[model samples]
Target: MIDIFGTLGPKCDNEIMLKEMFLRGMTGIRINLSHVKLFDCKDSIDRIKQAAKEAGTTPKILIDMQGPELRVGDFDGVVSLAKGYYQTLGDEWIPVDEKIIRAMEPGDEILLDDGKILAQVKEVKGTTAEIYVKRSGGLTGKKSIRIVGKEVPMPALTDEDIENLKFASEYGITGIMQPFVRNRDDLLAVRNQLQISGCPDLRIYAKVESMEGVENLENYINDCDEIIIARGDLGNAMPLWELPGVQKRIAKTCREHNKPFMVVTQMLSSMEKSAVPTRAEVSDIYNAVLDGATSVMVTGETAIGEYPHEVIKYLVNTANEADKKIKQNKTGE
Candidate 1:
């Protein structure tokens, strides 16, 4: 059966909810490294193991790594910037925090919350600088910040990542989803780190979420165990209209190479507040299965959704029905 991966978050962190998710047909649990703290993640892992034992099914655990993530400093609360409004990053318009601003240099491209707006540092002063917005979108407070074309020269193993990996080793999590993999070298770096950390058996799932990753997908797949088409930031990286084609290409590449691939982000977005999925959402999941996607991921739908177990049931039923139809057609039975 094609695996159904559900992300664990506020909704499904406890043992009771996790057991319900598993019984309802979630084959794997994805722990997002980007959101929860390390201690919380370890607790969740323990809960998952205990739940798995009770359910009599060994649910695969996927640890999603936050790789070189960039984010705006805390904005006190929420800062709303109007379109075409100029905001200074350095010492002129808004007061800049020294530590946060120090990481940036002139000529560096900055992306706010998955590249909603693109900016470049033109000049820098003490804890502040002038930035020119090459592309403009709504800039909210505490949104994800990323640097474009910047190779983080530091080791791929961050302190938090190391701690998480150590936990994973002890827990025997099924896989590690490496985010924002730029090339083969990045995969190697992560692999080397894992090996040194004594997790050489952990499967690596490379996340394709950038133009660079897409262009060099073959290399990444060769160096890793599986692929995850993370369309969240990827949609931000490229034109929203182009996501379909990119997703198709990613799925096709993975299939041709016999590598498992997962489609993630907003698969059942309506479930965030509602119990039922939209008609189009059902068809979308059906089409993804028809396209030979190895798995489908429900993020916020199962993470913080009001009906996390219902979402899991819906996806399983939808995919199962789709698979049956596909099989009937293939065999003409």
Candidate 2:
């Protein structure tokens, strides 16, 4: 089945909307743990189960862990600056954590807010790293920070993730998605943690979001319950123009391995603003299905969209059409 998934957020947080989405073809709800706490999402989780019962559908709850990804710590507000001024991230001037202050070095390129803001480190002094903003953008608090050609030196699972896993069974969470899975070892670490937490029943979806994860893909495919093509960070890892092709290649590999895979990120980006999706968004979902994706997902569209139901309508319509085409091609009619 071409399962349709939507991320739960403010726009579609009510039981009625959740039931509508469930009835309309949303088979799963992804709670992005990067921005929200697991306990904070308990109400929504309860609503999801309630909505599923109302819709008469057994929708799965998927919690996406923050993993070892490095992100900028909280800032009081937007820090705007012109290009060329030297600034240090995570320093008293920048407001990020000390780990960022230490792990980065001169000549390293740091992309903040998913590459929207670019800073080139010039030097690392005590607690401060001098840098220039190559690409100018506002530094929003708690946003993602990606260092080109390097990985953050954090544990595989965050402390919050460990605590959440301990309560996964209690929450009826059936699935777990680990972002930035570098290899089998990363998956094993999460798996072992889940087992220890008595959440052995939680199916793990290993997200391939970076070059390291892609290079070591084969080493972890069999160990994961499913594969998630998280193109948001994948786009950051590689050239944006190359992302579509990479999505197909990864989805194709999953098909060959007999593992269910999902294509996520910006499938209906325009829907996050407008009631209708761009033609390119429709084609993107179609191609992902054609590329052998078992599921197609949307995050921002449903999470913060003005037209959440409309977005799901388009997703289900497109997914249904592609599924029909797949069926027709298989049968000798």
Candidate 3:
């Protein structure tokens, strides 16, 4: 069966929602740790396992770990940037790490919200820098920022991740999804850390999100239990039009290496606001299964969407269609 995973958040965090999801074909739950602390997630984890038992289905827990991904700091609401306006980090905008901020040179391009908004550096002054907006755009705050032509230095596992690792085994987490995993070294480092924390059995799912991860994809395929094409941030690394090609290449390589792979992002994006999904969303999920995805996931749609369960219904139905076609071909029916 296609393992359908839903992201656990405010909308579906209780025992009832967890049991309801499993009853409707969900196979696992993904708890994202980017915003919340690991220890803070303990209650949710315990509740999930208990809910699984109550539902009579053993759903695996997938912890989404923040790894080496740089993101901008927060603001009240939508901060609008006009052309020729100045951006003073820590004042007008919250600052990211100095390492990432200092890496940008004058005239260097910076893409925010996955390249939807663009900014350029005009000057750098200590921890503060002034930026010139290429065009007028609005930033909703705390989105991932990509610096063009520079590699922002970040460690494989964060300090909080290490702190949380001490009890991953005790909690019995089935998998940990590492984001921005560029090469084999990241996989090894995370694996070593997990073992040191006494969670040697925890599976590693590599999230291929940047150009660096895609270029060095082969080096880490063997180390990863699952290869996830993070289509959202991955596209920001290169031209957006090339994303489909990049997604296919990664999925193809994973298949060649006999690795379980998945294509994520925007599978049911429309359903986040509407009860119904678009035709394109249906096709995207169907094609992902046909491309040999061992599992498919719904992130925001299940975590915070208005139609959480409906999103799963759409995803499961599409995956089932792919399975039916495959069975027919194998049996010549």
| Top lDDT hit | 2
Of the pair 2 and 3, which is ahead by lDDT?
A: 2
Q: What RMSD, rounded to one decimal, does every model reach?
A: 3.7, 1.6, 2.0
Ranking by TM-score: 2, 3, 1
Q: Which ten residues in a row have the lowest lDDT in candidate 2?
A: 81-90
- Each candidate: what lDDT? 0.79, 0.86, 0.85
lDDT of 2 by residue, 1-333 (tens): 888999988999999899988888889899989877788878889999999999999888999998978887776879885577767665577776677778878899888887888889898887777888888888877788887888766778988899878778999998999988998889889989988999898999999999888888888999998999999888998778998787777877888889999999999999888988889989888878877788889998999988878888899999888888888889954
209-302, model 1: which lDDT tens digit per residue? 7887899998778898888889987887766899999999988998899888888888899999997899989988998888887788999898
- Could you give candidate 3's per-residue lDDT for residues 208-322 as a string of tens digits? 9988899999988999899998898888878889999999999899989999987788799888899999999998888888888888998999899987878888888899999
Clashes of each: 5, 1, 0
TM-score of 2: 0.95
Best by TM-score: 2
Error of 3 at 260 (Å): 0.4
Model 2, residue 117: distance off in Å is 1.1
